[model samples]
Structures are given as structure tokens and as C-alpha cells.
Target: FASVVTAAGFSPNAHDPALFVHLSARGRTLLLLYVDDMIITGDDSEYIAFVKARLNEQFLMSDLGPLCYFLGIVVSSTSDGFSISQEKYIQDILARAALSDERTPMELNVNLRASDGELLSDPTRYRHLVGSLVYLAVTRPDISYPVHILSQFVSAPTSVHYSHLHVLRYLRGTISHRLFFPRSSSLQLQAYSDATWASDPSDRCSLSAYCAFLGGSLISWKTKKQTAVSRSSAEAELRAMALLTAEVTWLRWLLEDFGVSVTTPTTLLFDSTGAIDIARDPMKHELTKHIGVDASYVRAAMQDHVIALQYVPSELQLADFFTKARTRAHHRFHLSKLSVVDPP
Candidate 1:
């Protein structure tokens, strides 16, 4: 495949082997390959068509036309732009679980502690379900955190743990929910960084979460527990900011490879005033000394103008949804902001 793509005048992307880029004076085209399936896109429609013809000549490949479905995700084109969903995938999951008649809940509740009930007689089924849920979370960010929590007990799942699979039921009601990416959105880069201080009861580690937006549409997001324990909230928040800075830096490079130049420094919003101050100030306080190394990375990014860190009020902090559970109203607000909407 690499030889075929190279022969077709496309160079494979360094970051992703499956991606190929072709640049010419007229325009640029990107080809993404997954096994034998391929998605051809670029600024020049003619160039994209040219690549498609070349691939068809090289291999016995059929042109599926525009990308409406790939893998398990369904893409719907709209006047505004494009929307991606996994409705069919969700229904298939429900059918396999024998939960076709279940009702979807509006909110998710997760208990991270190890279950005290009897262990499942067959843990394989539980593991399989959890694995499937993890994949489904690709288009369903709302379930990311919950699925993360459930995944921890896959090896020794209990009856109590399996019961919490009600999250699947919740998916049944909102299966048509889709993520919208508007065509009019700019390429400006903006991101939100947040942390739930000492969220892990077992090790006292914080949970870090961040989401990056391109022209107000979500393109990247992550929710994971921090590696080291922090003594203070400011330190934890700084760690989260540092992680986000690294992500944004990589994303900026990726955009450049895609021929999208982001001239302005990426904006990183955080809810912690102390963390923001630490990132901006050259001198560090005694309380933050433990995180001096992590702080240095963030400071260097700021100094280089790679990222512009700003303080945001907790109420408007969008990454809050990824770090911790929120009230029903707050969850709905963040979901709306993330452009996760039900089809009309």
C-alpha cells in the first residue's frame, strides 16, 4: 500500500501511516487509507478525483462516492456542513445485549469503586460489552468518562458492575445524536483545559481533561487520570494545562500538514486563576515547586507563543464535563456546546 500510494505521487504522513498527502501548485489532496477502504479529500475537487482514478487503476477498488459511511460511523451532509453519528452501531449493540426495549436515561451516574457483589459467572460477556462501548465512545463523547470507569473492572466484573450497563440503555433513546461540524467555521484553534483535583479515591491522583476546537467545532478531546499525585489544586491544574499544551502543539503541526495554517497562537482556557498565573509568571512559588518540570514546559510554550493561556470562569469552562460529573443542566449545556445534537 505504501508503495502504491508513493507511486501515485502521494507521500505518507509522518504522524499517521494511513494518511497520504499530495501538494502541487494548484492545490493539495489528502488520502486516508484504512485497510483497503480509502477517503479522498482536498481543496481541489479535481485533484481528489484524479487521486481516486489513480487508486482505482492500481487496485480493484470501487468508488463509494462521497464519504457517507466509513467503518461504523455514518456521515450526513447538511447545508451547514457535515454531521457524524453511530446510530446503526448503537442499535446493533442494543440488539446484541437484548436491550432493544430499554429506555435511554438523560443522565449517567458512575461509581468507580470496585464492586462488592458476586463476581460474574462469565466475565467475558462483560468484557466484550465494555470493549464495544469503548469503541462507540469515538462519536459519543458523553459516554467517554463513564466507559472509562467501567473499563477498569473488565477483568473481574461483578453483577453490580454489569448492572451499571444501563448506560447502554441511555444510548437507545439518543441513538440518532450526531456531532456537527459546520462548513462556515474558521480554522482558528482554541482549547479548554480542566482538572478534577484528586479525583481518584484510591491513589489521590487528579483527572485531567481537555478539548480542542477548530472554528468552534470539536476536533480532539481526552479524559484521563493524571500520572502523579499533586499536593495542591494549582499544581494539578498546571499539569492538566501542560498536557493540553502538548496536545495543542501536536495538533498545530497536524493542521500545518493538512495545509491549514493557523497564524494566531492557540487559545487555552482554564478555570484556575492560580494555574494561569503560574503559567504566565517566570518565577514559581514554593507550593508549585513540586511541579517545576511540568510548569517549565507550559511556560516555554507560552514564551514561544505556541499557546495563549487565559483564565475562564468555572461556569463557562467547557472541559468541566470531561473531568467530572456535572448537574443535569450543566451536562446539557456542555453537550449543546460540543455540537452533539439529536437529528431533527
Candidate 2:
């Protein structure tokens, strides 16, 4: 496959080996290959046709027109741009769990411990359900923190853990929820970085999360507990900013393959003025010396003009949603920003 693409004057991206690109004076062509299936798009229709023909000659290929569905995501086009959803997938999951209840999503603030309640007679179903929900999270950024929490107890799920599956109820009510990507000519990158400072009762580890956007479209997000315990809120926020910088760096390189030039430094927004001060400060002191290398890495990136740090109030921090569960009103407020539209 490598030789085939190279023979056709296409080179695989250094950041993502699965993506191949061919640039010419006529226009640019890009191929994103996932195992046997591939999606090809470019401005040069003639070059696209030639590449499809070339791939067909080597191996039989079925051309799915306009990418309506792939890997369980339903892609629907709109006048603005496109939206992707997993409505059917959510329904199937609810059926498998034999859950028919419906309601708005509530807080995932349940304080579950490993030793809390009676263990399930069979843990197999719990593992399977958690795995399915993990896949469903691909297009469902709203459920990130819930899925992240539930996945932790997969090995030894208890009856108490079952009560937290109310997130599925919310899914049933808002099945048509989709992630919309609007068309834009701007080739810019920005991200929101946030952290929950030592929230876990079991361990003192903080939670770090970030959301990355290209132009006006959200591209990536994550919610995960930090590997090590953070001593202060500032430390946790700095770690998160460093983490987002790494993602933004990779995204910038990936955009270059699509012929998108990110001329300005990527904007990184966070609520921590302390972290921002620590990142911008040149001198190191005894108080911050224990922050490890993450904070220093962010400062270096700033020096290179790869990223610019800015402050945002806590209420507007979108990544805050992924860092921890919030009240019903706060949940809706944050969800509204990341999820552009909802089911009518």
C-alpha cells in the first residue's frame, strides 16, 4: 500500500501515516486511508478521478458517494457545512441494556468508590456496556466525563454503579443530537484547556482536559485523570495547558498536509491566571520548581511562537465541562457551546 500511494506521487504524512497527500501545480489532493476503506477529496476533480482509477486498477474499490456513513457515524450535509451523529448507534446501545427510560442528562457527580456496593453477579455485561459507550463517545463530546467516570469501574462494577447509567436516559431523549462542522476559509487553530484540582477522593490526582478547534469547527477533545497528584490548582492548570499545547502542535502539522497554513500562533484559553503567570515568567522560584517539566515545556513553546496563552473567566471555559460534572444549568450552558445544535 505504501508503494502504491508513493507510485502515484502521493506521500504519507509524518504526523499521521494513514493520511496521504499529493500536491501539484493544478491543485491539491488528499487521501485519508483507514484499513481497507479510504476517503479521497481535493479541488482538482481530474486528479481525484485519476487517483480513484489508479486505486481501482490495483485493488477492487467501492466508492461511497459523499460519505453519508462510515464507522457508525452518520454524516449529513447542510447548507452551512456538515453534521455527524450516532443516533442509531445510541438506540442500539439502549436496547442492548434493556433501558427504555428517557430524560435530560443530569450530573455525573456521583461519588462512586470501588468498595461501595454489592458486585454484579456477572461483570461481563458491565464491561461490554462500558466498551460500547466508549465507542459512542466518538461523536458525543457531551458524555465524555460520564463515560470517563464509568469506564474506570469496568473491572468490578457494582449494583451502585448501575444507577449512574442515567446518561443513557438522556441519550434516548436527545437522539438526534449531532456535531456540526461549519464551512470556513480561515485556517486558524485555538484550544481551551482546563483542569479539576485534586477532585478525586480516593486519590489526590487532578483531572486534565482540553478542546481543540480549527477555524470554527471543533476537532478534538479529551477527559482524563492525571497520572500524578498535583499539589495546587495552578500546577494542575499548567499541566493541562502543556497537554493542550502538544495537541495544538500536532494539529498545526496535520493542517499543513491539507494545504492549510496556520500563520499565527494558536490561541490557548484557560481560567487560571496563576498558570498563565507561571508559563510566561522567565525566572523559576522554589515555590514553582516542583511543577516538573510540563510547565517548562509550555514556556518553551510560547518562546517559539507556537502558542499564545490567554485568560478566560471560569464560566466561559468550555473544557471545564469535561473536567468535572456540573449543575444542570451549568451543564446545559457548557454543552450549548461545544454542541452547536440539538434535536428539534
Candidate 3:
């Protein structure tokens, strides 16, 4: 596949090897290949068509017009831009689990402890369901936190762990929900970094979460537990900011490779004033001395103007949704901010 794309004057993207870009004086076209399936997109329709024709000539390929469906994800064009959803995928999961008629859950409840209940008779089913839900999370950022939590217990899942499957029921209600990418938004990168201090009762590890936006459309998000225990909230927040900075830096490079000039420093919003201070000031404080190299890494990025750290109040921290479960109102607000909406 690499040779084929290279022969056609397309170079593989550095950040994502599956992506190939053909740059020309007229315009640029992007070709993304996942195994045999490929998605070709570009500003020049004629160039895209030419690439499709070339691919068909080289190999047995079926050109699916306009990309309505691919790999279980459904794409719909809107007045604004595009909406991506997994409604059909969600329904198939419901049917496979025999929960098509089950009542949907409004919010996730992941307070399950390892000692909460007896182990499941068949752990395979639990693992399978959780794995499937993890895939469903590609376009469903709302369920990312819950899915991350549930995946942790895959080794020895119990009844309490299985209860996290309520997220599937929640998906049933908003099965048609889609993420909208606006056409008129800027291409500048903006990101939010947040952490929940000592979120796990089993371990003292904190939870780090971040969401990156390109031109008002969400491009990436992550929810994961921190590897090391932190002494203070500032430490946890700093670690989260470091992770966000790494992601933003990679994304900036990706945009530059796509011929998009990311002239401005990426904006990184954090709810921790102390973390921001730590990142901006080169001097080490008593609270931050014990911090690992991640703190220094973030500070250097800030110094190099790779990222601009700004303070955001806790309530407006959009990454909060990825770090932990929130109130119904707050959850809805974050979803709206990410442009994840149900079809009317």
C-alpha cells in the first residue's frame, strides 16, 4: 500500500502512517487507507476523481460515491459541514446484547469497586460487550469515560462491572446522535486539559482528560488514569497539561503537513491557575519540585511558543466530561460544546 501511494506521488503522513497526501501547485488531496478500504478527500474534486480512477486501475476497488458509510460509521452532509454517526452500529450492538427494548440510561454511574460484587460466571461476555462499546466510542465521546472505566475490569469482570453496560442503553436513546463539523470555522487549534484529583478509590491515581478542537470541530479526545500518584492537585493538573501539550504539538505538525499553516500558537485552556503558573514560570516552586520531567516538558513547550497556556474556570472546562462523570446539565453543556447532537 505504501509503495502504491508513493508511486502516485502521495507521501505518507508522519503522524498517521495510514494517511497519504499528494501536494501539487493546484491543490492537495488526502488519501487515508485502512486495510482495503480507503477514503479520499481534498479541496479539488477533479483530483480526487483522478486518484479514485488510478486506484481502480491498480487494484480491484469499488468507489463508494460521497462516503455515506464506511467501517460502520455513517456520514451525512449538512448545511453547515458534515455529521458523523454510528446509529446502525449502536442498533446492531443492542440487538446482539438482546437489549433493544431496554430503557436507556440518562447518565453513567461507574462507582463499581473490585469488591462490590461476585465475579461473573462467564467473563468473556463482559469483555466482549465492553470491547464492542469501546469501538462504539469512536464517534460517541459522551461514552468515552464510562467505556474507559469498564475496560479496566475486563480481566476479572463482576456483576457490578457488568452494570456499566447501562451505557449501551443510554446509546439507544441517542443512537442517532452525530458530531457536526462546521464548514465556516477557523483551522486554528484549541485544546482543553483537565484532571480529576485522586478519582479512583482503588488507586490514588488521578484522571487526565483532554479534548482538541480544530476550527471549532472536535478532532481528538482522551480519558485515562494518570500513571503516578500526585501529591497535590496542581501536580495532577500539570501532568494533564503535559499530556495535552504533547497531543496539541503532534496535531499542529499534522496540520502543517496537510498544507494548513498553523501560524499561531495552539491555545491550551486549563482550569488550574497553579498549573498554568508552573508552566509559564521557569522557576520551580516548593509544590512543583517533586514533579517529574513531565512538568519541565510542558514548561519548555510553553517557552518555545508551541502552546499558550490560559486559565479557564472549572465550570467551562470542556475536558471535564472526559475526566469524570458530570451532572446532567454539565454533561449536556459539554456535549453541545463538542457539537455532538441528535438528528432532528
Error of 3 at 121 (Å): 1.7
* Local distance difference test values of all predictions, in order: 0.84, 0.84, 0.84
TM-score, cand. 2:
0.95
Q: Which consecutive 10 residues in model 2 have the weakest lDDT in total?
A: 99-108
lDDT of 3 at 4: 72
| Cα lDDT tens digits for candidate 1, 204-277 | 89989999899868998888889999888988999999999999999998899998887788999999998988
Model 3, global lDDT: 0.84
Candidate order by decreasing TM-score = 2, 3, 1
Model 3 clashes, total count: 0
Instruction: Show the colliding residue pairs in model 1.
Output: none
TM-score of each: 0.93, 0.95, 0.94
Cα lDDT for residue 212, candidate 2? 86
Backbone collision count in every prediction? Answer: 0, 0, 0
lDDT of 3 by residue, 186-254 (tens): 888999999989888888899999999998899999998999998889889999998998999999888
lDDT of 3 at 287: 51
For residues 1-344, could you state the per-residue lDDT of candidate 2 as single tens digits?
Answer: 77888898898889998988888988899888878877888888888888878888999889888889888888888677888899889888888565555544545466678887899999888888789889988998888888898888998999988777778887887788888887752557889999999987788789999998777777899998888888889999988888899999999888877888877899999999999988988575346877748878998899999999999999888898887777767766776787546744
